[model samples]
Target: MTALQRIEQGSALQQTDDADLVARIDMLNAIGIALSSENDMPHLLERILIGAKQITRADAGTLYTINDQQKLNFEIVQTTSLGIKRGGSSARPVQLEPISLYRGNGSPNNKLVVTYCALNNKTVNLPDVYKENDTGFDFSGPRLFDKKMNYRTRSMLCVPMINHDGKTIGVIQLINKKSINGPVAFDDDDIHLLQSLASQAAIALTNKRLIDDLKALFDSFIKTIAASIDETSAHTGEHCRRVPYLTLALADAASRDQKCMKDFILNKQQRYNLEVASWLHDCGKLATPIHIVDKSTKLETVFDRIELIDTRFEVLKRDANIARLEALLEAGHDKDRIELIEKQYREEIKQLTDQRDTIRQCNIGAESMPPELKERIKQIAARTWRNCDDELVPFFSEDEINNLLIPYGTLNADERKIINDHIVVTNKMLASMQFPDEMASVPEYAGGHHERMDGKGYPLGLTREQMSVPARVMAIADVFEALTSWDRPYKKAKKLSEALAILGKMKQRNHIDPDLFDLFIRDKVYLPYAREFMDPELIDIDEPSEIPGYPFDMP
Candidate 1:
């Protein structure tokens, strides 16, 4: 055969016919599509390096990415012959020093071949680095590496990965082409194929990085909004922070359960979805008024109206004293008559003091006010007193009457409705955001946390079957945080036992998820959660049986 024919036929051991060449090109095209579709940076980078090595049959390879500091970072390295690997799928980091693209004087670094290729946007095809003298690039580092690792330093093909804007983002370095007989130098075909792969890889990497940057920006925006909401109420800021953690913890526990692992297991994207949802669960509270949110007593509005009531009681006492003195004056100099009038005056004062004390006690709104207390409030409200208008009027106005008549908590019905409207606002606010496919369920999951399992929840009356596990988990987290929280103005932080008992009762009444509650108790999700977020004093230990509805034995 002629010498030309022999060369055109390619190497005898690694023969490449027209058909084989076409098949490899087709495979390269398929790999390019796959690379572009990969969203993960680490995996995409690993795939790029591995794909280059596979196509060229290189025994060793290294991938470098250019950093903002004008340095080439060693991202992935692989040497198959010695079973040496670092970074990427090896789960180990590459410890090699970075190559700087510029020197201290701000001159382009052209000594190292990788840095030179990246600086010039050129491809370096060195058949044998030890014998190369054409480019005047340094090979001392490779020689030292070969000596230290006891490896041969032969052919090298370095290709610059250029993005759409003709900027070099990285370099792909391939070492020693392997064959059945011995190591072979890289040829023109290898160089051309690798360059094409490098181009596709550059675009893919650039796209993935862009996506990552955008995701980071979006998350920052979400957190900023959540932080603003938290800032609106001092008491709820920590609550906002704690619920996400508890949600993740309980969700993770549920994911590990053997009984329903298939149904509950979360992928990386789904976990992120749930986490973002948990953080934004109570964002609707931002629209609520601070006065209603911080109302600590029934008569509180700018300040406690109970103070004004006390002033009125003082006026009544003053009037009683004046009437007693006038009656004594009318009795003239009769000592027995004066003593009787004075005795009656003392009784009147005692009764007035008792009524003042009763009204003060009713204003506190600490516990549930009984029917008789409410009725007594109405009767006391009916008693006439002279006002600044110089007309006899009821001691308590109608509005005050309504406020003091609140059967439970500090807020009246209207204020409670205002508080509940926040969830509706939250649903509306999140619904307007254009979430990506991976996080599409964020709104639904976050919005449903306030909904009841029995269809009694406000805004949207969703039933148990209508809610997702993540949403249900969020509900539990929200309730648990509120129950154990000491910062709220309306209620004291319950002990761990008390909180669990309330949760148990909620489970029994279908206010929360029963199966999830059982799993929560069984897996002891609350203990670790309390340790992380709850006060040490609030973590009171108790038996599962003593908790109102905790299931002792796991099914």
Candidate 2:
């Protein structure tokens, strides 16, 4: 019989005589719900193909999704009679060439059965492919398979999986519907059932692809922000990349800790969220001024103001020389008096030179500056010097004096506040965003990294009890990265031993999370990280036993 005649007969049989029709309808509804609930792409595609085969009792089927090149890309293929499965979750991959939906000249490719279904957005039922010759599609693929497998090319059903927008996204093809007797033509009842299932599959696939695209876009956005922040300082850029690695590594280690298994272990979503938080922790630094961040010396602003102070010292030397010359000219008639005046002038110039050297030394930042030295800065500031207006003024301005008197680090109090305010800005920026439920803790974890265990840290003085484990994980990562980092403007990278010692001290003083620090040492997370990212010379062979407060005996 012709393909059309067979379809008409199947439709008549479907309406009047099928006792199992109600059961099939219920099965179709259940399959649709199952397909809709599947979120995994490979599993979903596999389920779609499997569902169509079971409903039609087909011996074989192939699921194909359209690619950007307008080709029918085989996503899943299964053959029950041959025990063949490829693609989707199968160990074997689909090696078949994608069927083109458009030829080189861009005309519709209607010669292939799958392409024909996708192009026309309609189902094709062939009762017997070997006997049919009137259909516009080529059956060479199935004919070749039959020849190779010693199988017969018989009944077929090809349905277009169309999305809600009425666009064909893919095609579902079933071959050789099997019955108790042998291969039989897929009837209109089977055709209608497969089409309904294909429709649900298309919507599910579309929604999944859309969600995947959005996730990809969101990841790119985060990376772009990180790159932008990194571009602001060549020194800080490496920190942005390395800290995330360390954060995730430490987190993974913590997750494996048997003592705190319940508290520390992370699910896949939680791990992802922690990783995202680590990458974004320093995003607030984007708001901090580059000059302050790169300030290598105490007197630095746009440029070091120390040079301006040096010019004033030179002016004082010149004034002293003029006075000495004037005295020499006046005392020319008195030799002994002239000698005394010259000696006094030389001594006065020597004092000014000493003071100038002291100020220059003070300009360099150190771990600590003494009170005595700070008082001398005030003394130096009081020394009189003539301005362009000829009015005498203090040798150093109030702001310059304050910068020079900074007891620790390059930044003065106001500049330090500006730098610290980045955390505040970071909190605000992340808090304002609406994250998915899986990532809702991103703001909290990222914002609390700077907070100390003893409530001594900035932006918010959140104590250990208030902070989450992930937040504490970030805090340790941030501290360690900064300590061993060679990219800072003012300080050299600390050796592994030195960095760990400082961290140990911080733990002893309640400056960081002690339990996490112990795990960091016991787990040996630092060694591998240091080998990868630290300068070779800085990677020392200090044992965890030697690190103070590391609790080497802890189980």
Which one is best on TM-score? 1
Displacement of the residue 467 alpha carbon in candidate 1, Å: 1.8
Candidate 1 per-residue lDDT over residues 446-555, each given as its tens digit: 99888889999977999989999999999999999988988877678889998998898898889999878888887789998888877898887844655643545655
Per-candidate Cα lDDT values, in order, are 0.86, 0.88
Candidate 2 global TM-score: 0.89
**Residue 432 CA displacement from its true place in model 1, Å:** 2.2
lDDT of 2 by residue, 97-118 (tens): 9989999999998998888889
Give the TM-score of each candidate: 0.91, 0.89
In model 1, the number of clashes is: 0
lDDT of 2 at 160: 94
